[model samples]
Target: MTRLPVLRTPRLTLRGWTFADTAAALDVYGHAEVARWLSPEMTRVPTPSAMRLLITRWIAECVGLPPPAGRWAIERDEDKRVVGGAVLLRLPPGHEDLEIGWQLHPDVWGNGYASEATYALAGWAFSHDVDEIFAVVRPDNARAAATVRRNGMLWVGETRKYFDLDLEIYRLRSADLKLGAQTSQRPPGHGNDD
Candidate 1:
């Protein structure tokens, strides 16, 4: 089994999904608001049983996936709640580009969990020798676009290359990640670690 590294930030832990996380995972993937943005790649998870199966597949699939290219549950440290999901996977077709993405339960939308996860995932990918990571956001997904921008992902125009959807592509190099860390403010309630 490929053991995913546990990545930590001030307020979140980006770690592998476990069977115990199935219900919390459902709270994130079962909602249409979160699922809609994931269409074509993933459909809304309908039932607890289905979600359990999906989690099983995810856990099984991790063994074969390359390092740093897998999914994680975005768990908040304060209450240890699984607030969202994060991914660093290869884009489709050519499979040469890496895509960084996050999906939060709508209830936790403004807490900056996604932004923190993005940086944590990107830094982890960089440590694995990946050069640049991209985030493909639907033009209508203003919130996601803002998160990527906040993480120092540069706008690189639109593409229909990945999920067969028109998406605005944002690129982030290792240097850009450093710059973003130097300038971006932590979300309220997030501290520099007392």
Candidate 2:
């Protein structure tokens, strides 16, 4: 069996999905608000058996993949709760690019968890030789788009073919990532950690 690696940030844990996280996974997907941005096929409340299978598949994929690509369970360090997921998918065929995506519990909205985790993951990807990272957020998801921007990604306009819905594309390069690093190192009280 392959083991999934764990990634940590100051406030979050990005790790492989485990059986223990199935309930939280289901809770995240089962919520209408949380599922709004996901594929329609996965919008329903997942059965425990189905969630287990999904988690198993995710663990297998992570173990077999290299950096710049894989799914992760987003856990909150304060409460140690599995809140959601983050993914860095290797772009398809002609693109030879990388795409970053994430979803968090609705309750955590407004917190900077998503942006913090995204910046850390993007840094990790850069270390693996990924030159660029992009994110496609639905036009209606203004909050997510803002998070992408706050992380130093520039809005590159829209793409119709990227998802089931029209999406606004945002991009960040390894060079642009230096800004995030500097911002992250600021003394406490200078800015919110989230």
Candidate 3:
């Protein structure tokens, strides 16, 4: 339950969520395009206040969550703006597998941010002793499927185990990662919140 690690890629920084990031977060989650993919577990955040409450909950929950299991704000290094969100959480029903997810604003859709975030998350998780990670995409989510593939995840087929809906599962093992593509983590006090 230490502070969420700060992950840095060449162009983006993945750090802990903060109340101060509500508006920027809303810019991503408030849009129908982005929220449509996150069904059942989350709906479109209606307002800045609602987004703030959600961030508060995420912060509180992470304090008790295990290493590599927390949410992160995907910020662009050049502009220092939050462009999306990322998470590594235990899959439901079994809670044995770790799932990696990313949500990006439509404005930044084609920028390779999702792929960068995916690699960063995978590297961070593996460095903490996680053997493998998964990404479950809705059957029709081509963008997500492509992103996972671009990150070197292999399609393992479909399942209805998570969220009670059909999803395409993609997996990446620690041994599959390329050397030097790993992300660098800042210490507890070096992240956004502290």
Candidate 4:
């Protein structure tokens, strides 16, 4: 496993989560708007201390993560606040099942941050040797679906295949990286939150 490097887009900085980011992480992760679509592991951090502990664990865990598979703190470099977070990880314990996801504070929703953060993460992941990246969105999560779509991921429709829940699956081949709506100033329906 190689250390994941910081990734940046025109407006966002996808960097490793720091211990000092606890309060920001707590503020974003604790909000119902941000937590609603995230996994239980993210929404269930009971306290700031718990959040810090978990972030510490994740940072430690990154050491063993294969290339292009690590979590990032999504920062709007202009404001330097933690607007949300992004993830690029190998799903189900295999290197082939790479996934990309993003979460943004509702207050910052509709500003294209989710799409930007997600696209940046996906681009970085594609730079590695993997052939493709997948995004598993709950069937009902329209916002997330839009985010993936805007990033040029092709929908493979719904299935219970990956996370055990019925999810809408999407994929982007490495050859297609940065070739579509991902580099646009504002993708269609860009105001939606994830």
Alpha carbon lDDT of residue 143, candidate 2?
75
Would you list the clashing residue pairs of candidate 2?
Answer: 112-194
Q: Global lDDT for candidate 3?
A: 0.84
TM-score of each: 0.94, 0.86, 0.90, 0.89
Model 1: which residue pairs collide? none
Tens-digit lDDT string for candidate 4 (62-179): 8888777888999888889998878887766344688888778777877777777766777676667777888888878887787677667889888766656778889888655566
Q: Kindly report which residue stretches of model 2 are placed more than 4 angstroms away from their true locations once superposed.
A: 1-3, 92-95, 181-194
What are the per-model numbers of colliding residue pairs? Answer: 0, 1, 0, 1
For candidate 1, lDDT tens digit of each residue in 90-163? 88989899989888898887776776888899989999989899999899988888778877889999989987
Residue 47: error of model 4 in Å? 1.3
Q: What local lDDT score does residue 134 receive in model 2, on the 0 to 100 scale?
A: 91
lDDT to native, each model: 0.86, 0.77, 0.84, 0.77
lDDT of 2 by residue, 1-194 (tens): 44545779888999877889999998887678788888533556558888888888878878777765788899999999988899887654445668888888888766777777887788778888777899887888877776777777888988775544677888999877777666555443344323
For model 1, what is the error of residue 119's alpha carbon versus the real structure, in angstroms, after optimal superposition?
1.2
Assess candidate 4 and give its TM-score to the true structure: 0.89
**Which of 2 and 4 is ahead in TM-score?**
4
lDDT at 178 for candidate 4? Answer: 64
